[model samples]
Target: MVSDRNMLANILRTELQIHKSSFILGSHSLICIFIYSSFIHQHGGRFHLSPLREL
Candidate 1:
């Protein structure tokens, strides 16, 4: 039962992280256009994760 709960929590956390990443991308694009007149042609506005996540 504890393992099952942990799995569920892990899934939820991953989903939330994906959602947050998308949000940050969207916000970055919006702010870049607002301040710079357009989105920068770079890749700093991305969120990357490690190969293994234990959290």
Candidate 2:
């Protein structure tokens, strides 16, 4: 029973980490896309990606 509990805890922890990482990655990509699109619109479609590196 103790081993079962430990296994369950480990599974929960792994799932939590996977969810957290995916959430962070999704938000970061969204921010990058938004910034890139806005930059393109502001600069008349010219592609200068230097500012995105700062973020």
**Index of the highest-TM-score prediction:** 2
lDDT (10s digit) by residue, model 1, range 1-55: 9999999999999999999999999999987556443222233544334312411
Q: Which stretches of model 1 miss by more than 4 angstroms?
A: 36-55
Q: So what's the TM-score on candidate 2?
A: 0.81
Clashes of each: 0, 0
Q: Whole-model Cα lDDT per candidate? A: 0.66, 0.89
Q: What is the per-residue lDDT of model 2 for residues 1-55, given as tens digits with 9 covering 90 to 100?
A: 9999999999999999999999999999999899888888888888885966643
Clashing pairs in 2: none
Question: What lDDT score goes with residue 33 in model 1?
Answer: 59
